[model samples]
Target: MLDISKLERRWLKYKIKKILPYTLLITTVTILGFTIPFVLSNRHSSKAMIPLKKDAIKVKAPNTENDEGAMVLEPSMHFIESMDTPSTPITNTPTSSTKPAPTPKHSIAPIASLPTPTPAIAQTQATKAPQPIVKGKLTSIKRDDTAFDIHEIEDRFKDTSNPNLGVYIAKYHYDHGNYSEAYNYALKTNSINNSIDDSWLIFAKALVKLGKEEQAKKTLQLYISNSNSQAAKNYLDTLDKGGSK
Candidate 1:
């Protein structure tokens, strides 16, 4: 027995020192392994690894674009952003995104025989055309002395078998600019009707117009729970902006 505890302490220290260098080396190797692949993938792509044949990867001459997929449509980010905003114009002049001049336009000229646009006289037809009608039906409820009593309207709507009578009345009230009454009716009707989102929205619109901003916000949040229309989104954004001057 050559002082066993001393030997054990020395052995542990030696093992720890040896293990620390290898552990650091392993960690460095793993970090490099992940980072190298991530950086390469981001900065440059490996086109050679792509399975497209040479024929499929055809390139057009300089100034010409490959138009095989020219008809394919892409959604624009600018269009999406503009949907919710009044667009301030981008002032930067764009680089020419066009390819080489189209061959049909390049060779064609006023000297060559060409078809003329139809004259206005030729385009006009001598027939009466029907006017466009919007989808909503106008309720006879008037803004004059003959408007429906709010209580009677609410009571009648409470019991009416017709599902849309309440909505029709809400729209009628909204059209008349009776915002407080409209909000009241919509709020009560929505509570009675069990999550009718449209009613809640009419309430929200009225609240916004009436300058009850917090209530309008809550109403919109409730409505947005059930709808994704751009109209709803715009209304909610209007509420967020504290309404227009």
Candidate 2:
């Protein structure tokens, strides 16, 4: 037999608004008092106070290096000369005409007709077929394209000491389906260094593409550990289902 009280309890607890009002926040000290997961001492023992050993706390203050100088931005004026200049002129001249006199005709040999000239040999031969333009993988990207090589981007991050370049490069590789390389490089580019949740997402996507199902599952689980992973967690559900869309 089903319990009657359980249904009533579930019904009464349906409104989250009702429960939210009861969850009042308490101080950290109060929280620490009751939340003793481990009881090291007997409850009946009177307080045994020992002098707290004062450890020398070394405070490492950030170097107060004054920024080099205030950026001196030059003010500029963009003067655009409008092309529609109004005043212009059009010129046309017509001159008067004069009449001339007539000339006499000759008889000669009318029976003799002019012979047609023989055609010349063809000047140009058929041009050979132009070679097809074939494209291969590029090794090193330049500043011009800002892309081409995965290593180039990695080197950029190395040169600039900017970890963000790794995120960009990893995303570029993952988006292009170079998942093996993406996953390989992602190991070096720590997810914590990039946008935490987003990097993990890209890593999961790369892992999925690389056919590392178990690793991808674990990666997604790590993502859901965050407080703000509602949407990511929903996506994780889809990934868990192996439902490729």
Best by lDDT: 1
Which pairs clash in the backbone of model 1? none
| Winning model by TM-score | 2
Q: What's the TM-score of each model vs. the native? A: 0.34, 0.37
User: How would you encode candidate 1's per-residue C-alpha lDDT over 111-202 as one tens digit per residue?
Assistant: 11111211211211111122243346321211111242434445656665222445435644654567777676666667656354456656
In Å, residue 33's CA in model 1 sits off its true spot by 99
| Per-residue lDDT of model 2, residues 95-163, tens digit only | 111211111012110101101111110000111122233345322211112243445556665665343
On the 0 to 100 scale, the lDDT of residue 202 in model 2 is 54
Cα error of candidate 1 at position 131, Å: 26
Candidate 1 local distance difference test against the native: 0.47
